[model samples]
Target: MSAFHVKVKWGKEMYPDIELDTGEPPMVFKAQLFALTGVQPHRQKIMLRGATIKDETWDGIKMKDGVTILMMGSKEEDVPVEPTEKTSFIEDMTEAERNTMLQLPVGIKNLGNTCYLNAVIQCLKTVPELHSAIKEYKPKQPESSSLLTLAVDSASLLTLAIQDCYKTMNSGKTAVPLILVNLFRTTFPKFAEQGEQGKFLQQDASECWTELMRLLMQEITAKDPEKTAQNFRTSLIDQFFSGEFSCEWKCVESEEEEVTKSTDNFQQLLCHISQDVKYLHTGLVARIQEQITKKSAILDRDAVYTKKSKISRLPAYLTVEMVRFFYKEKEAVNAKILKDVKFPIVLDIFELCTEELQKRLLPNREKYKDMEEREIEEERALKRGKPGDVIKKPKTRSMPFSFEDDLGSNNSGFYQLQAVLTHQGRSSSSGHYVSWIRLKGKEWLKCDDDEVTSVTEEEILKLSGGGDWHCAYILLYGPRILEVVEEGEETEVETKIGEET
Candidate 1:
């Protein structure tokens, strides 16, 4: 039924070599083999030629025209024992295999000997507990990313050691590529099953490579070979976020404010707020990391930890909070100390988190769903309107609409904010500002910039449609922040902050 390569000796061990037959081409190797053979293998394992193999049946093929070959008894005791508990060098293995196989070169995150991972890697072989720690960090899911960390900070040192005894076809002058190639070869097949990420991988690989190269290039050219890579990383980050990604600011306690405070209540508030915010941020990051661990499409290139010591100044060029205090009597409410992820990346970690959340939340949106048929026509009209092209006013906006609070959980203290019908063609302007907000809580809760200045009707009208308007700013604060004060002519509770982009 099928072809076979047989080394037959009566009463001797059955040594085997396999060759495909039944006229099966490599691509059709599996399916054709099944059709030819009346007997099929019990289990399937992938072979190098994209063929699936099962337990071989000598009966399925002719071993020298049905000559009965006797085999020696199974050598159960001679079976190889798998090593556990530790890695050991055996004389049987070659040198290159030991270095290239055991020592992962590329994409291994070399945490500055400054971090805890270094200690873990150093003691992994020696200590069982340390080995377990390493195991814990490995990705449990196929879709998730494994943490790219090194046991030592100086992978280059490790590289040099390997270089002295063994040579690898190392290029790019960095050990990263070698490491990445091994990783890619190992993991790419697992992911290629779904076939969704091929395009993204192709696109991201070049950009990421260029980014790394550009960073290294600067340091080499400046005669500061030492600082080149690190500086390049920093510069890449700066460039990416220059004008991309709309970010909204949330206030955290400033360091100067933290150190100056002698009050116990003040300290407690900071600790509590910090704890809450930290919990939220940590949960978000964990979800992202978990995804990276599971998906191969996502590279856990790096986990960015914001430097906690420094203060955060909002991006330059966008002057949002020029006039600090909003809401007249409200005390300090600002994000003084800034801590956030440093790296700008589109990792699978983020993607998996997004997918799971969307499933649970039912937030799937088809592309361009928000565009109306009329809106599409309008866009077409606009595109055609070049120089000397007459523009047409949009169709009538006389449709009626109303707003209702999503009272799903009233206890959430969150309101269901929506838009309502405004008066017909009223010349008066109404505005909703979302660019930024000043914390408008009591002396205990507010972060520095709390007082809001009152503006006239004309000033408000001009920028009501400034593109960033959202529902309304919601506040949950103690009653102390609700004091009424008569200022100027009007006694309005001015809680808005100066506009920021």
Candidate 2:
């Protein structure tokens, strides 16, 4: 049998030059690991890209030479042969105390002012597509960055660190992303260099989000020989987050028919502060209809330009940055707009679209409305002690002009709130960032550095910013897909794509 070398890491130690035959069962590889780490094959759980490799042949897993795989689970722990019987009493604890004792929260460990990174990571975790992308990543070549001072390559370290964290989270374990933090700080000298009293300072959450997203995009394309590493500017961010605006420019002496038509792209939807604007939908709609005038290129006189943007292609996850910070010339600081602009759990952007795009969206909107009405009727019937008929939602089909081939395509203009990154201080430079993520309906988790606690839907509504407390700075909304059900299937069925990856 032909054997190839691979690297295996168990805890802090890496065992290199481990050879295994490609045709052999995974148990054969585990047997060798057993000799090195004193861990039995049954107890060992081998993982690749945040997924557990099954106890099958290497061929089944597409294992290649020099592949780095994560090995979890420990050697057998010593347990007592005899058990000590103890008596329990009702007075042992109060109901609240017992519930508190039963709770075990999963969270990250804070490394200085790394709460911003933590908050962003927790928020991004809510995206199932991103999770799938990270799991499907396979390194094509060895990282060869000599600038890295760490024992391992900077890129590989960051990738493995994040993949390991994802794997741990999937296994329901809490861990600190220590390796990623170290490499991130090292790669960006500004992040590591900037601080007060010789300590790392708090960083902006959006900046962190952008940097991490860039790295992830690069990793996604690294395995393909045809494609090179891509930055966020050229990757899915542009494909999905981008919106197109049609600009009609007319000269001062020009007629209506002689106007020039151009297109502009925007990555974020700005929520302009206005007196009557209370909801997110209203602010976005207002921004899309504004007109302005500027000096024409050929004609040195002023020209009227009317610009209106409509999303031509919708990404699975839409990121909306609340434009709350503005530079103050007199004070030499960034001022915050603490307007309580209330956002919705379900946001509809159909009205903001062009006439043509609106026509394309109406079909899906109608289907979604019908699904909602049926669900509501079912709920009412259940409340009235009447058996309701099981209805199957229509399966999603492909669209020609969609954003990308990736998952998370928003067929309709409807979106549901997935995550929110909030800031607590007055200035952008100095503020605490926390992540409020929607786990499911009416259930949210508040991730504040090393602490994570449950919050109500009411608490999320209050994050719109009216006080000195944490306010929603960045909102991430994902497509609200119609729930897929089957006839005679009374139980709710979760239709998850790319679960294997």
Candidate 3:
């Protein structure tokens, strides 16, 4: 590795032998990798059509007007480059690499771009037969210009195409034994920029795209399709998501900040259609469908998942906000024996909490066996207590807010403070139950880190609007809950805003 190098500041300043394999050299490597997108000029080849020099000889390292010059490959070929904009490169998955990185496993993403790229490359590298078959084909196009963007679009294309092929394979149809980019090149050449310029005076390659697809399926994909797809998929994941690479979550909120906000657009599930994208029809369709679901707004909205709205499927933009909502309710509901309760258990402890709620309402026999004992218990508690004054706050069903009270009670390990506040979240239809107890900053901080997901900083700000929402009612037998109930005699339960806490 005796390659000397010079690190020249592109815009501001300049420098003159730089280490090749290290330092600024890495930038060169990275730039080249980035350029690998559309310009698929073989790994070791160079194809610079138009340049200012009489020849391609630019000495040592030179920086002229925001351009960095480096001797590339066999001859010192100077290439102009720039760091890809962060926004352009790392698309904020709310919106929006190359080989040397692959050393591990990937997940079953509907469309993991990295997986697609790795899989397609592996599929191609492992099976040379696939290449020979593809070499016989070329892209056909009504117009040209599309050819120019091939390199830039390769990543998206490869992933999308592989996904397509996977979908087709899933449909019980045979798929390519190797990567299908060639098939994409052959079948959708118009899209791939391979335009029908046959090796020997192209004679309109193949008019029927379908026929090309048929030939591809018959010859390549159909060969041990499943293994090919699986192997390709496995190899891909193993290569990309290796080690040391992980995401860290820091609450966009700072300790000093009073409020936080986050905007959660659901576009993460989108798979941009790429010109080079090639995959089995079955897999492709399945992926697109799955993606449609993953980013679906209906799902993200945490709306009372109606079967009808879900029929069309939700888009990615709205899906981000649907964090925890899915599994949270199930976990909460499963926390206790929710059904087939002893009505007697209900009646035994009924008056201890609130007598009004236990009244004529359905006992949910399936939910409770008896209710009288609980009613009597409540009657006794009320008897010990004075005639409670019920504050009448007319129920406002329109707003997404509610206030409820629960009385005092106790047990062994920790007294049975049983007031569980159940209220519908602004975005949810079903009521969510949170212990009305007020949590400290530490707890909120923990929630900030764990409970929150997908919602963006911008969105959170709007919802929270600088308030800690740091309050609720959680006492098992606080004076609040007992205020509405009377003696063993029945009484009315009313809600009032001015009522004292």
Candidate 4:
């Protein structure tokens, strides 16, 4: 019976009133020491008096209440410190070593039910322009003058927190966005809602994405002010994520009423899921034209109207949200639809645009086709050429996909899928969220909380909602850039306004 309470001293810290049982192996005490300090049990060296403690048993050791024991060890370092010696280069390493050195991007740790926030942050980080904006954001002192001023200050602080988290992740360490999570809870009180057990409840990922964009819209502005002078959009969110719809409203019941026309701005496109919708394009098309009951001026009463909307302006980065959750009266919850919907890697919205916008998009569409054909021909010629033979490079041509006057407006209605935020559960309120981001050509990264793995293009296509597996909730699409190569210069990729090179 050698059970007694003792104090352990490690480095400058001391653990007081630690109960130890000698009946159990000495390894248990080392494990307790490892828990107190970050050092592993194997690395821990415990000393009682002048004798070293054995891991097998406490044979010759005699301990009393309040006895002080010395422990020494250091926790393993996650990020390597700068070496005092010569730096290693990738060219000096073998092929296998080089492959090992190339690591995937780090992920964010989930704080309670913050997977929705983590997933949205990862997907948004893939946008080069957004990342640059966050890096450049300067925080100001808190202003308590008015509600609007307070909101702006909060948004600025949130942006800085996100920048700090990104820096930590870039250092090859998994980031815990503790400050950002707190700021988000403060800014949007809805996220602070707790469960009956006093724990934070899971939320919808799409809702989190929308709220974050709203906060960013308040703080992030365009990098170059000169380019945004002619356009109505001055904020980065407006320039990169906003789109305009040309809408026409016609009274369905009153045939004599005149059709009214209007324009509406949208941050993201909603893809409404229904029994008739099997493809993403079809769902979006169905959403564009719908019947609504509203007050009519000619009828002077509530009447059914047919509203038709067409894309008048397209942004550089297109956000499409899948409307999978619907409110059920019986359950009083946002239930999810598990129907499978197909989405394409390359999306063409030529048919979904206004007639005038469609006309303007034809020239750039033709240029993209020509570039693809030329690239195929060059590959064939390279395969046929002999060693040391030089194939003449094609002359470079200007391919501007963005409109000149409207800084971030896309001239061509074409987009490539960039990132996807997915949810896995039966309902929106209780589910796991994960982010899948495209890395270079045909390669993808699946970020599940603090675990990140490499995935292929074929694997990404299977995320289109089917069952209990991951379902695509939100999809982010970036403009498909056309690359042109010059004889004397390297190939250049075109980008939208405010985009980093």
TM-score to true structure, per model = 0.15, 0.68, 0.16, 0.74
- Residue 246 Cα positional deviation in candidate 1, in Å, after optimal superposition: 3.7
Candidate 1 residue-wise lDDT, 1-501, digit = tens: 554443322133222332334333222222212222211111113232232333223223333322322222221224567856566565654543443454422112221211111111121112222122222221112232221111111222222222211111222111212222222222233312222543312111112222322322222122222332222223222211111121122113222222111111000001112223333223223322211112112233332222211111111111111111122234322212222111111111112122323342222122113324545654576565554555443323221110111111011111111111011111111121111111221001111111112223233222212123221111111101011122343432221122110
lDDT of model 2 at position 325: 86
For each candidate, C-alpha RMSD in Å?
A: 29.5, 11.6, 27.9, 12.0
lDDT of each: 0.22, 0.66, 0.24, 0.80
Ranking by TM-score: 4, 2, 3, 1
> What does candidate 4's lDDT look like per residue over 242-353, in tens digits?
8889999999999899899999988898999889989999999988889999998887899999999998888888999899999999999999999999899998888889
Residue 132 of candidate 4: its Cα lDDT? 84
Best-to-worst ranking by lDDT: 4, 2, 3, 1
Pick the winner on TM-score between candidates 2 and 4. 4
lDDT of 4 at 338: 92
lDDT of candidate 1?
Answer: 0.22
280-364: candidate 2 lDDT, tens digit per residue: 8888888865677877666667776665555554555788888778889898777788889899988887777667767767776
**Best-fitting candidate, scored by TM-score:** 4
The 10-residue segment of model 1 with minimum total lDDT is: 261-270
